[model samples]
Target: MSEQQKTVALEAELDALRREVQRLRARNAELEADRGFPGRLVDALPSLVYVLDLEERRYVYWNRELAELAGGNIGAAAGPLRGDGLSSMFHPDDIGRIEGYRARVAASESGEQATVEYRARGRDGGFRWFLERGVALGRDPEGSGRRMLGSAHDITAHKHTEQMLERSESLLHAFLEYTPSMMVAVDVEGRLLLVNREIESYYGMSREELLGKVVYDLLPPAASASIRKANDEIAAAGQPGASEHVLVYPDGPRNYLSTKFPIRDAEGKLYAVGTVSVDISRTKQAEAERAEMQRRLIEMQQATIQELITPLLPLARGVVAMPIVGTVDPARAEQILTTLLEGIAARKARIAILDITGVKGVDAHVAQSLVGAARAAGLLGTRVVLTGIKPQIAQTLTMAGADLSGIVTKGTLESGIAYALRARRRS
Candidate 1:
């Protein structure tokens, strides 16, 4: 209970504490020795493992891979890796991103991990993409970053693959958007899945407005019906089919040659119908115009032929000679009748000489046509004089029951003209 006894007890307790501390240190060393070789183990890994003193902005510990990635020995003698040190190691465009990640990791709580991907300069002086993940170890007394541990894995191949995929998607999008035909895809339920720029432009609507809508919703009932029929046929046959229809736009109607085909996946299961329509309105209009022109041309040709066959020549003051050449069918006979009646009314002719010098033979119909013409002209007060009937034609007409008794017959066109003039003089 005295001061000496208390002092002795305090010394004993202090000595015991020191011995316990020494034993703990020895145990830690033994544990470290029992583990695998740290240097060889770290150097064998492909990824760059490192520890950093964030307060001093220096790499406290780094593996051989880290040194190789940095293109230098990475230790205390290598100098601190701050903004400038890191900027030199990263791509110029990626420096800002690296700095942003550094700031984030420095502010993170202990055991909080942060990941960043950036292009880093390699030993070969070429930049390669790397994915780095860091955990905040602890903070300093002032609440600043004290230490951090991280690993960096080369992701150059992954980044390159990503870029290639992006380019392929962009190219496919461009091809679908700018193709000239109106391309569209509809699901089995008739819902639109895809639409091209041509379809958007032709319908004056955006793809957003067209997609997910039923084809019937975008088109008139008539047009939608036709399209539905074509789609059904394609779906049933699992093949392509052609359809032509008029697409009535807000401006006007346009003809389109639509080709519909079944869309199948690699598994050969029919999933949708793909349609490609080309505007054929101009072609259709051209064909219609050509047909109209052909009809008009035929009318002109017939008019020319009729005029050549029937020619009325006036000889005397009151006499007119109509010379008919070539065989006259019923149509030509009707034309002759019309010409003779018109000429008689215009000229007020007292005698009309009908010349048929070019006639080979007159059948029953031809003889009737002549009789009908003469009777019609008599009713109009124009006497008929038939000319240019050969003897064999006259005999043929008589044998075929010809009834031209009431018509005056002449041998030649000249004789007919002379007779008409003589009759006019007497009058």
Candidate 2:
């Protein structure tokens, strides 16, 4: 235990330590040589590969893909983010999301991977999307995963595609929900695929309740059968057709003009049917009203003509004039007789003038009707005078053997009226 003995022993131990250090360095060199091809392969990958220390919140290794993604060089994001470095290389909005993604990776068990989509800012000052898939690389003393190995693939194109699809679906839904006419589309199975607002309102149901429902089940048997026939015809002919059918409800029945057509896919195969209907019940009602009004108008016109043809006018007190115009058929001759008698009784006229000044021809029936009116007035103590005795009319009455014995005859209506006035004054 002397000083000299202790120095000798210390020197021997130092020598042994030096030999052990050299052996360790040689072993390290051998391990590095063995990793040559694998390291190169990892560097050659297209994916941005990295190893992260979950507990340290920093990166342990990064491949060359990081440099390529950051635009030919790492630049600000060359390695793990330094103080405030993350804000410069990654989108500010996505920075907050990284913590949540990291937490999920840290909590996952071995062999289980977690995926996150985030945006990163490149050298061009534009943001690009990346999908990171991370798995637990190691665990801590408490068995919690603290290290993560992950790869990120650029997913900007895929994200754009998904966004476009969502936009298209939204536009289609809007068109189907707001149109004015009743419209519906059904698959071959008769399941409702689309319905517009008008259809929903007409059926007294909401879109949520109507879609996927069977059209046949919602309608009456008569309506459903008619619609089925139309649909079948359209499908078989592969053409569009129009039809009219009545759909009834508690309120009433509605007449609809519907256009039903087959819907074909790109392969020209029939897969669905669409119907657009317009309610025409009001049109039908208006037509019926118009027809009824026309009938009434015609009847009124005929009554007015009858009144004009057979008129009995009072010339003065105790004197009435019957001016007959146009051809007198048997029906009209009777009307004249009835009117003359009624006029004499109603006005208490003592004289009646039968003026045929405008008559074209007097047949036996007409001559007889005139004599009958004169005799009928005589019974009421009213004298009758006949005027407008044209030469042809006198000859015809004589040839028919008609009797005008008691009836006074005048050549013109003016002479008849003047004579009656004079007779009245004398009486």
- Candidate 2, residue 210: Cα displacement in angstroms equals 6.1
- TM-score for each prediction? 0.68, 0.57
Can you list the residue pairs that collide in candidate 1? none
Give the poorly placed runs of model 2, Cα more than 4 Å off. 1-91, 119-131, 137-183, 195-214, 236-243, 257-261, 266-268, 276-427
* lDDT of the structure predicted as candidate 1: 0.84
Predicted candidate 2 versus true structure: per-residue lDDT over 69-104, tens digit per residue:
655334445456432334556777887787788788
Give the per-residue lDDT of model 1 (tens digit) for 1-427.
Answer: 9999999999999999999999999999988876847877888999988887776777767787877766543543455555245457778888778667777888988777899998887878888999999887888788767788888999999999999999998986897787887889999989989888988887788989988988777788999898888899999999898989888878799999999999999999999999988999989999999999999999999887777779888887778888877777787888999999998999998899998888755677877787789889988888899998888778767777767765788899888888878877888
Best by TM-score: 1
lDDT of 2: 0.84
Total colliding residue pairs, candidate 2? 0
lDDT against the true structure, each candidate = 0.84, 0.84
